[model samples]
Target chain A: MADGLRVGVVGATGQVGAVMRKLLAEREFPIAELRYFASARSAGSKLPWRDTEITIEDASTADPSGLDIALFSAGGSTSKAQAPRFAAAGVTVIDNSSAFRMDPDVPLVVSEVNPEAVKEARKGIIANPNCTTIAAMPVLKPLHDEAGLVRLVASTYQAVSGSGLAGVDELAGQVRAAAEHASLLTHDGAAIDFPKPEKYVRPIAFNVLPMAGSIVDDGEFETDEEKKFRNESRKILSIPGLAVSCTCVRVPVFSGHSVSVNAEFERPLSVERATELLTHAPGVELSEEPTPLQAAGNDPSYVGRIRVDPGVEGGRGLALFLSNDNLRKGAALNAIQIAELVAQQL
Target chain B: MADGLRVGVVGATGQVGAVMRKLLAEREFPIAELRYFASARSAGSKLPWRDTEITIEDASTADPSGLDIALFSAGGSTSKAQAPRFAAAGVTVIDNSSAFRMDPDVPLVVSEVNPEAVKEARKGIIANPNCTTIAAMPVLKPLHDEAGLVRLVASTYQAVSGSGLAGVDELAGQVRAAAEHASLLTHDGAAIDFPKPEKYVRPIAFNVLPMAGSIVDDGEFETDEEKKFRNESRKILSIPGLAVSCTCVRVPVFSGHSVSVNAEFERPLSVERATELLTHAPGVELSEEPTPLQAAGNDPSYVGRIRVDPGVEGGRGLALFLSNDNLRKGAALNAIQIAELVAQQL
Candidate 1:
């Protein structure tokens, strides 16, 4: 597979990092060597990547002189401080956090949506779009290319994992509470217990919460996640000034993210044309049967139920649903994809 | 309390009926007498209302003659055929299905939205709006009264019980299938054997199914559930041509039906004002923190996350969320309230 590439994973002990390592191994990336980098809390531990155990270095104190590339899944703060240092050493940083996405100098991407943007990653920090936006872009961009996206009204069913380990813990606790006793609230019958809310602001067991991120600036422009959807779409599709309004919520489901998108187009978009286009679109899987669980652990963005928006007349506008693995396409897989492209260019 | 009323419950053994019976007992409806009716399969089965025992009659065969009022949670076929007979026998019928909801002669009522509609049940059928519609109606109607509803876009996360016990079983079975290790298609996860396919069309475990009923009329307005969301909203809200487009999904959630709605009004409606209105609106409980589990067995149509629709300008519109016990205000509680209104008019 050409010359094998040397790879380094940042935030190696975190959820997205673990997934990144797994995907790299599963996809059989031709790795000549592998290394991991984490915070001091996880220094010296080794991760199994393609049959080799790689030592993890601490970002603050460890040297990165030999690494060819470093993938960062740590939160925004860590990425802000460490990404540049690694890049200064001539290592490309494929960052999974939101740290550099909005910077005009740094390109935000979904591999299939805007792989071309990678060349413009002058800052060395290539940003991954928010998971919710990533799941939708692969499907919508192609359609929008055909029928300009004039405006959109969307809602999302985001899985707990979007928040990481804490999210998964919250749901397990809430569902247990639902099983144990009847809630005075409504009627799921016996409530089961998981834990008191140590993570999310509210109990998520046997329940769904609409509060994704704190109300975005008086609940105006967008929730933090919602804005990611709008601005990220603009950047990825290379279409600025696109009007996108979205409502994103977190549900009890453990892994995939699902969105119901209503797009009003400048021209008309018939179901026939849209479906035919999506049928062959890269990174888009036409599921005539899209659902959150069916999307769990899979890579392709699942699209289904194409119909007229009725809100917008004709074949001119339409609505559909999307679900995809937030951890993979949403984070790790996309990072690996960028690294793959960089390995070629370097 | 107003000379205790005699009540009969049709489909008493079904999911909504069971909930209806529980609500009747829980709310302590002023019942001097109570009777249970079901399809032939459940005939002779016992239903315990309070400390008393009542045997369910075969709704298809048993006459509706001896009741003061009958609550029909039975399916539409039963409602269409039997409601008239019950009304002819001097029993008012509060139907929980779509059979008569759009019928001009039948008053579509949600106690809080249109208790007055009960006075207009001339054809003897007091129709209940579909569950998803009812959950949002009580909250939306008040907002509509203040600001004319221009358009509405909604996505629902409905529980299994909306389909009945078999639905709950289907979801339960799918969860267990994970332990057994089976591919999604061959697993047939719906538990009750009766829970399997030929019913839901696809698996329901850990997933969300976008379309709820069969694709009717080539899917322009497919699914019996979708039609009800459209048709029922029109009749109940007095908007003959309301812009109601929806994606009704069945989630792994067991009870409440949660909706994410983006509603536009002729005049501007702020999220704060909607919250204020909902707090005092009849039949609506203002949830400081609204969630599906918390609103489960409760009676209120809880509304929260009121915010202006960023998609629209003019400060005239808002988008919010709702989670209500589909069995309560969406089904039983509403039916009972309609029955209450009919008794008063009589």
Candidate 2:
């Protein structure tokens, strides 16, 4: 840890924030000094970092003078408000929010897929692609290189944790209620005294919500999460013309996000070749049947159930499934990995 | 009710069998005499149909003499052995098992989609399509009729109840344990004390199992459920040339199976046109965001989130989501509805 850099973690008390801190330590991310920041309500709270404790500062008022790098996992508004300010203060911001992601100046980087893109961050800020997109990058990058990937249809099985701590609590509470009334729920779903949904539009326990994100009012009729998948995948894969139709669904899983992808390419791609590519791909692991449980708390995006999609003409399409820990590889770990890449340059 | 028919429900003690009995009474199928039949283990058990108790007869050796219609919700082997015997005895069998679905002789029917096909049951066996296939027929029949569907890519969120009572028990048991150790599961999926899975490959309490059916050794590497989605969709839709790629996932929900379908047609089908068609389609209720909870115990296949799939050329592809009660519409209800059709003919 000789070249440890001073780092500040914004939103230190949030769900992804907790994982961010853990990865920083677990991955032995070089750190000389650490500072934690949260909203005003959580200011002055203490968070442990290895041998010592750090007092949390309200992100709105925190001074960014001495920090070399700051990770913002707070929400979009916080990144929109504070990221530029930190950049002005000479701190590189690797924002985990959607704020700077689509910005022309900021680079949306997936460490393995587009690490070199980090050097082009003109605004001194890098955006972490959405978790769903990040999970796809490692798997798609390898495939796209082999076949000229043209179109994709993705249906996701997203976890409750992607909605943050409240989503987790809602699912936990509902599960408890449903479990208690197991006999009732088995025959009749309405009889399970499900708690009134607070965080989601419907009960998140033992249910699959077809609508994951808030429906974007735009006439396109896609959820904001769905839009992010299209936009982010295009930017990260550098395939601006790539067409995607995605249905983002929230499942009862705790952490991992699984995607069933059917990709159509310009050229024919066999299951055998795709398997070979994914087998040696960075940040991806091939499994027989990848599930959330198998991917949770793990680093690699597990890919499996590879088959030829006969729907596309002349065997040009391939259908496969993938699972990745939304919290780790999807969010915190990827951001930390980007920070690590930035750290080396510093 | 006019034209009351004598009905015998094979596998009357099973999960789907229970639903069949309830639906028979609920729908007032004009039953002059209701008889129950199950395997020898449950032969003597009594189940209440309407105002009186009906004893379950042994399916293997039970006399099929006087029964006009028999609904078989038992496993495939039972349906294979008993369906023929009943059919030979002049009783029409609406078999819910996969035994005769692919048989060219058996008319595989979804009551709303292909009621006319019921007249072609020359073998005296009308096969009810798989639960997942039944949910898609109503939604697809309208679209296919309009645009001439050529291809389909389906990703399913099937409830545990689709697996039977044991699946429900496994999920209920796991949820109980997960709720007891909520904190452990929320943070670490591996930390949860999940019971050894008997009905499923992995824990199904709060997780999604991508592999719904056992992988068939046909080298296609697709699960039996996946194969059913392909074969049944082709047969029921009567689009023998239709190409299908499906990933069937078992979710934690006690009832209601949801499907995310991306379909390509020979002609252009706009979102508005698709929505309009689904609005008045039989056995389908168009919801803004269809979920398993909302569709549970409901007969209609809840369809929503209709969108244009830009993946296909010439504006030919459409994407949509649908949910239906796996036990009702997917299993028992369809059989009952087919039985009603048969009753009308009788």
Model 1 deviation from the true structure expressed as Cα RMSD, one decimal place: 3.5
**For candidate 1, lDDT tens digit of each residue in B272-332?**
7777888899888877456777777788877877777766778776878888988777788
lDDT per residue (tens digit) for residues A251-312 in model 1:
76777899998888888889889999999999999887787667777889999988887766
A159-262: candidate 2 lDDT, tens digit per residue = 98899988888887777776666575564675666768999988877788888998898777889999999999999989999999999999988889999999
Worst 10 residues of 1 chain B by lDDT: B185-194
TM-scores of all candidate predictions against the true structure: 0.93, 0.98
Q: Each predicted complex: what DockQ?
A: 0.40, 0.78
Provide a comma-separated list of chain B TM-scores, one per candidate.
0.91, 0.98
Tell me how far the alpha carbon of residue A8 in candidate 2 is from the true structure, in angstroms, after superposition.
Answer: 1.1
Q: What is the i-RMS of every prediction? A: 4.9, 1.1
**Candidate 1 CAPRI-style tier:** acceptable
Listed per candidate, the RMSD to the true structure in angstroms reads 3.5, 1.3
